[model samples]
Target: MSRNELVRICRSNSIESYLQDSKDVQYCSRDKPLIQFFKLNTNAAIDGDTDGLGGIIRDSSGKEFAAFSVKLPAEAIHVLEMKAILLGARLAAEKGLTYTLLESDSLTAVNVISEVWTCPWKAIPVLADIRDALFCLNNWKLSHVWREANTAADFLSKPTCCIKRVDIPVVDLPIDLLDIIVADSNGTIYPRL
Candidate 1:
């Protein structure tokens, strides 16, 4: 199928409706000649609370290909969430991806990103950057997700400073905080997701 035809189909149909049999479709690598899609997730840790974000890029298969996270002070989490979106956009552009989805768990953040929240502040600059980067892509979508469904990115934002340092390069944070986050993450029993 031609690129324009595929894009038209994507715009008209749900991703699952387009690609029901993912096993039959060819999966492209970073080096292969293929259309690239990007998904990015981010979370910011402020004080004792956290704000999570999740972004997805539905290419032919509609799976997440690239994602990331960011942690910051609770009071500054909103600013950091905007920054994460900017960073995710930059990453997508760097990969030469033409389709992108930017998602966040914070409704406020998503609103600002989607231009539903009109007040502009410190985030105006980066949000503008995200806006500009988004224009470069042929297709894009921004969405909000509940924190429970976005675990891998949440894991990346765990409070590291509070954790005790082990031989590993990264320190594990306080057990109590870890327990709470782990429990919040889908209630799954995986030691680590």
Candidate 2:
């Protein structure tokens, strides 16, 4: 098929439809996979104090793709939020994914990410970077989810463990929070390679 046809098919297909079809393909490549696999399902949440931003990224298959929590001074919550969004976007781009839908528990943050209104001064540059990153992907969206539904991101955002990249089995509680459990159980916390 022609490239135009491929683009049309991608543009017309939804994430669920694409994932259903991916199973039949032998080896998926980046060429059209981002259009297919990149669901852009994101959720970000901040506490009342706004000291940190927590979020998640899932591909089309509903898999736990990426999770992050970034900490900031209470005074710099807005700026840090933009940075967090940008960081998420950058990670998505590096992974050759597109068509992301960013979600935030904070309506204010959602608006800023979506450009529904002006971002605060300290946030403008980071917001600009997020816009540029999404533009490169050719598709992105932002929405808000309730806090309860955003637990995955919230867990990731907690101030506990050091940051590293690897596939981790889902845990009921975040590792940082689990430290308390470990201490009580008198078990050592081991790092996994």
Candidate 3:
């Protein structure tokens, strides 16, 4: 976004889209988490007739600790997003990670998880599970970010073959996702031209 447009959005206290143009989005890298905290970026997307969820957990230095790509039955986007977060939180807890900063491109999911908005009926069950998973953590925070900053997770959110769920560490990540991870750690920003 341009300086003037950003200023306008700040003044208005509302954001519709952070677009330089309808056909384009300014790309960027994901921010690293605070020292001693892990960052888990999650995304939910629809591919063809199926729903998919993706998440990546990174250490404070931006090294990937774990990542997941799973397929789910078609559902509302908010529900799918909450499921992705829930799955991530469980993975982090299983790895004994104490501090976490969970991020998602879905503002609706963040707002719901943070209780900034009432939980919608469709998302209640999964959101409750998410709370349970997060409760096991020593400390955690929920945040919303632009989709551009969540490129890896977004790319990984495409549905794979049936029952072909992937949950693995950085070294085992697919080549495409590994490329994004490398770019993110190197502070390389892609311009969506």
User: Across residues 51-70, which tens digit of lDDT does each residue of candidate 3 receive?
Assistant: 99988888877788788888
- Model 1 poorest 10 in a row by lDDT: 25-34
| lDDT for each candidate structure | 0.52, 0.52, 0.79
| Backbone clashes in model 2, listed as residue pairs | 40-100, 40-101
List model 2 lDDT by residue over 20-118, tens digit each: 455442211111114355433233334556455555566554455565556655656566556666767776777666667665556776787767877
Per-residue lDDT value at 71 in model 3: 83
**TM-score, every prediction:** 0.53, 0.58, 0.80
lDDT of 1 by residue, 1-193 (tens): 5444443444432444434434354321111112554555555555466543322222333333444444444556677767766766776776677766565667777898887887358777778787888777777777775664444445545554332212212234345434533443323321111
Q: In terms of lDDT, which candidate is stronger, 2 or 3?
A: 3
lDDT of 2: 0.52
Give candidate 2's error at residue 5 in angstroms: 45
Candidate 3: segments with Cα more than 4 A from true spot: 1-27, 161-169, 190-193
In model 2, which range of ten residues has the least summed lDDT?
A: 184-193
- CA displacement after TM-score superposition, residue 11 of candidate 2 (Å): 40
Candidate 1 runs further than 4 Å off: 1-37, 47-64, 69-75, 161-193
TM-score of predicted structure 1: 0.53
